[model samples]
Target: MVDTDSVTGTAKELAGKVRGAVGDLIGSDRDSVEGRARQVQGTAERAYGEGKDALRETADRVADAGADARDNAGRYYARAEESVRNAADEAYHFAEDAYDDGGRYLSEGRRAIAQQVEESPLAALLIAGAVGLGIGLLINTRR
Candidate 1:
């Protein structure tokens, strides 16, 4: 839409042209100069109006860009948050699985040790005594 000033300026310019033409027909120097001056004023007002329109358009574009950027940032933040939560859930499941595996392995190892000790009680007792002696010697050395 054309600015109000632009429309007004156009009307003024048309009037100025008519006035200037009449002055020329009547040979009036003062009217001729006045008409020319009015034309200049009209041109200037039109330019000012056009400039204001351009500035308003530019501001609107900038505002749209800002809103778009904000929306994009919000979407990115939401995606990032979802990714972190997913990773945390994966880690929790992985840790739970590892704990379960460790407990199963520990139970199997205990059962194996019990079986071995039962099969050779004397040998297990001898090995335990040797380990205790070695630990005692190590403690004395450290002290």
Candidate 2:
């Protein structure tokens, strides 16, 4: 009962077809001609309404597609942001592990050097002298 033009026209067209048939059966030329004219008018009106409906449907679909694209873009951005955050966390943890390893190595090296110096003071002194001599020679060459 929305009374869309297409529905109204379709009803009229059916009525016209029935009237035309009845007129033909009863041998009334005037009634038959009028019914055929009405049928043609109804068909034109129905076609016009159908064209409008098609255009409206196409517009609605276009709007929906635009909305869907925007939503998909938002989802993609969120996923990319999450990926970046996860990668940063992984990189930070990796750097922290490396820092800890470096600290441990430095501590071990210090302990080893202290032990060596305590075990042999004379050898430690000799090694220190050799290092100083080497540095002096390098500097003299640069000069």
Candidate 3:
């Protein structure tokens, strides 16, 4: 496309030169001046077309770079998301194991307390009263 425009402009320039020469030979100053103006207009138009072509090419390159950058960013985000999901899954399993261990410990503690209460009712009552007092004090402090 650029080559075609360049060729057309060159042809126009040559035609203008020939017309100007003919007008000069015929002693027509107006025709000669008009031919010169045509030549100048053709040159300006060709320059404008070249500038436009350069700008268009630059815009296309920039767009292609932007698309590549976006694609790379998307890939990175997907990988990061997968890593976070895997980490979350591992944490969930760890928490479940900890909960199971805590439950077992609590069960054993409850059994020991029951045996002690059964062996000594008076001691059990005293301990229960002490625990209640401590809880009441904690509540009062919060208030």
Candidate 4:
């Protein structure tokens, strides 16, 4: 990236040198002093331009670094969101399986109870009465 200020300053500096040489050859003190001043001004201008270019380069690098950090953070956020979604899905599946197993266990227990009742009606009736009495006693105790 060429700086226009630097190029202009360089051109001005060269012109000043030529002007100073001509003044010296012709014995003109005013022209020589003016030429030297112009040279100093040109040097200052070139330095200012160089400094500006350096600052611009630094700013560009900082901007690029910020963009990279933002992109990385976005990727990390997406990965975290996916991980959370996967965990939620796994938890839901686990709960569903447990619920199905619980239902199956309840149905099997009812079937076994029915079978026992069919095999021994008198025994089942006595057991039912005992269970009812036990429940009644527990309820009265709480009251």
Q: Rate the local accuracy (lDDT) of all candidates.
A: 0.67, 0.66, 0.63, 0.67
lDDT per residue, candidate 3, 1-143, as tens digits?
47454556566667767777886889665556555555554554454455445544555555667887656655655565455455545544554555466567768888999999999989999999999999999999999
State model 2's lDDT: 0.66
Tens-digit lDDT string for candidate 1 (1-143):
67787778677777778777887889765565556556655665565566556555555556667887656655655565455456545544554555466567768988999999999999999999999999999999998
lDDT, ranked from best to worst:
1, 4, 2, 3
Q: Candidate 3: which stretches are off by over 4 Å?
A: 3-5, 67-143
- CA shift at 104, candidate 1, in angstroms? 1.4
Which stretches in model 2 have alpha-carbon errors above 4 Å? Answer: 1-65
Of models 2 and 4, which has the larger lDDT?
A: 4
Question: TM-score, each model?
Answer: 0.51, 0.53, 0.40, 0.51
Stretches of candidate 1 exceeding 4 Å from the true structure:
1-65
Q: Whole-model lDDT, candidate 3?
A: 0.63
After aligning candidate 4 to the native by TM-score, how far in Å is the CA of 135 from where it should be? 2.2
Report the candidate with higher TM-score, 3 versus 4: 4
Residue-level lDDT of model 2, residues 1-143, one tens digit each, is: 12276787688778768877887899755556556656655665565456556545554456667887656655655565455456545544554555466567768988999999999999999999999999999999998
